[model samples]
Target: MAPENQPTTGPSTFIGENYHIWVIKIKAYLKALNLWEVIELGEPVVQPLRVNATLNEIKKYDELVTRSPRALTCRHSSLTNVMFTRIMTCEIAKKAWDKLKEEFEGTSRVKSVRFLALKREFELLKMKDSDSVKEYSSKLMENVNQIRILGETFPDQKVVEKILISLPDKFE
Candidate 1:
């Protein structure tokens, strides 16, 4: 019955890049608002087939069906125009979220390709001679985040070791 409040600062727009990060942020926002179950499990069907259903009871069931979708719409509205258009046709939030996931996140084949590409990038990562320690650290962490999102597990110690190895001899 109450309107869902908008997130004070929504995630970055869903451009061709940044789907992983954007979705993660969006999901967190939705979960915080208690709207994630609808997106993840869909709206539950409230059976109105009772032989003696009261009018108020039917209305209550109707509200339940619409509530999740409305919450999703509020959250989805934060997207950029192009991204909004992509999910505009979805009548409910679950469908919209799924459509976005399929479109940007892709299927297993695409995910595998992306995972391989991230792995390659991680392997080739290096601290350039001209790069500052901060810059190199940021680059390494960015790759680490992407790899993690793609379902790779890299222990903190291993990441630390990799960073140490990547540093120039001057840092030793």
Candidate 2:
């Protein structure tokens, strides 16, 4: 088979921060390249070719084997050297991804604490008289996005309601 082309741009290197955003970007990147399954679902399991195996069997096996390394390579290239050191021994992308998630994502308690803080911020956010609607909305959404990074599915309807209530009386 011919060599495949890769995208010109990819996710930001993981440098011990913004794990959520990096994961989101990288997942999308991998999905676009049809490489996310190996990372998400782990490597594919295939049987060895039998003696006098058909050409199709060889091709299928080759593709499965090749994807494992390709996915691993994508993960390797996306990490900072310091981060890469943590996963240096990971020959599979799934293990590397899990290791990063377990380490940086913190424990459930830690995530809960963070989620609550962001939730409060989201709840208390109000537009100032001096701030434009766009600016105010942007700030509000930034907080929401951070909450999502924490793994909550913050509702779009709720954000819309908040935006409506946050507007100054002059706009009403």
Candidate 3:
């Protein structure tokens, strides 16, 4: 018998909020199943059996074709009813992904505005002299994470510098 009580690694249902985090989690889930390529790149073309096609090539093509539906299913099952309706007719994983991205992540203009706001917040973060280092660092990291979630590049060095500059006078 298979092992019992094992926790599954399925993606959590995608509600309206936290779409960025859900995208990251769902990608991880798809990658674990070797189906990310199907979701990311869409259905692979099935070649007619021909003399020129190597066995490996045929096998790879078959695998992609077979896994495409499974990848779509994974994406479908991860959505809530309200979210599911948005992509109900999507026949491919990539289409479903794009639909969700467009709907929940917002349009490019909206995303650009949000990115700027988060960037500004991240830059303006300051550790108050009276605040404990732990509290201030926690707030700093939270802002950094929000910026990173928006697909911006915020390096650890920047965080370190922010920390150093914001150190209380006693720690200097």
Taking the tens digit of each residue's C-alpha lDDT, what string does model 2 give over 46-161? 78889998998999889988887888888888998999999989998899888988898888899999999999998999999999999999999999998988889999999999
Please tell me which predicted candidate would have the highest lDDT against the true structure. Answer: 2
What lDDT does the true structure give each of the candidates? 0.79, 0.88, 0.84
Runs off by more than 4 Å, candidate 1 = 1-17, 49-63
The regions of model 3 sitting more than 4 angstroms off are: 1-8, 50-61
Across residues 54-160, which tens digit of lDDT does each residue of candidate 3 receive?
Answer: 88889977786778888899998899998899999998888998888888778889878988998788778888878998999899898888878878898999899
Worst 10 residues of 3 by lDDT: 1-10
Clashing pairs in 3: none
TM-score of 3: 0.84
Q: What are the models' TM-scores?
A: 0.76, 0.84, 0.84
Better of 1 and 2 by lDDT: 2
- True lDDT of residue 48, candidate 3: 68
Give the lDDT of residue 110 in candidate 2.
92
On the 0 to 100 scale, the lDDT of residue 145 in model 2 is: 91
